[model samples]
Target: MLVSAAMLLTLGGCVTMSGDYNVTAVDANGQPIKMVMTSHGSAIYSSRNAFCSNFPKATVTIRDFHTGEELKSESPYHCR
Candidate 1:
């Protein structure tokens, strides 16, 4: 039981809890234009405005930190 408990604790510590998401903006040629870190979808808009001002036509994609899943995608000009 003690060994099981110790293993559980060790495994729990290894689990990552980071919720930060990566917001990447790429140009029409699929070249990276900008990158931002945010925790949620709503935050992406503000981050987009800040990081992607010079690349207004860029395609923006939000990805999960751990799973690398594409959570959202939109154009910088279309973001609110």
Candidate 2:
């Protein structure tokens, strides 16, 4: 029983879940833009367009763990 309990604790600690983000931005039209995104615990999403119907015209970039990756993306062009 003790061994099982230890194994459960270890497994639970190893389990990591993704995070959620409610992102908002502004488009050229001056409107509010919102998107719901799901992160893979790595703090990286495939692309902004994947989450929302419209994507900002501003330069968008995504990086890996080794590289510096921006967690959130927003722009006036998107909300407007």
Candidate 3:
């Protein structure tokens, strides 16, 4: 029983799970302007001056890289 407990503890360290999302902003030319990886939804943003200045009508997309699912998308944001 002691050996089993030790094995369980060792195995626990190998168990890893991540729920990270990839946020990307692209210009009208389909060029990636900015990208970020985060675990929280609130960390994503749609507006960026550097990206939007070059491509005023840029698109921002967020996807769950782990699950291969798109979480959100926005376009035609106002940029200064």
Candidate 4:
């Protein structure tokens, strides 16, 4: 089980995001369900929007790691 989990994580990748920000998926009730610490670089988080579809009332929030600036928030992703 441990090996399979490791293999899956290796192949699946982390959080489906990459950038210098805190990316989080918030559920309808204003609870963070998924979050990832991205590497420092240009931002590209297109897949984060999918959480809205999957969770229906979910929101995807991207914030600057250093300054705490909110960089993004789309249609279905309204954060608390």
On TM-score, the candidate that comes out on top is 1
Q: By TM-score, rank the candidates, best first.
A: 1, 4, 3, 2
lDDT against the true structure, per candidate, is 0.63, 0.42, 0.56, 0.59
lDDT of 4 at 59: 73
lDDT of each residue in 11-79, candidate 4, tens digit only: 976444434766567788878785564534434344454555566666776677787777744223453
lDDT of 1 by residue, 1-80 (tens): 99999999999766333455777777766687645666564665676676557665567777786788876434334322
- Which candidate's lDDT is highest? 1
Model 2, range 13-38, lDDT digits (tens) per residue? 66343544333344445454454443
Q: What is the lDDT of candidate 4?
A: 0.59
TM-score of 3: 0.44
Listing every candidate in turn, what is its Cα RMSD in Å to the true structure after a full C-alpha superposition? Answer: 11.3, 11.6, 12.4, 10.9
Clashes, model 2: 12
**Angstrom error at residue 17, model 4:** 14
C-alpha TM-score for every candidate: 0.51, 0.28, 0.44, 0.47
Candidate 4 TM-score over all chains jointly: 0.47
Better of 2 and 3 by TM-score: 3
Model 1 spans with C-alpha error above 4 angstroms: 1-19, 34-41, 73-80
TM-score, cand. 2 vs. native? 0.28
Candidates 2 and 4 compared by TM-score, better number: 4
Model 1 scores what on Cα lDDT? 0.63
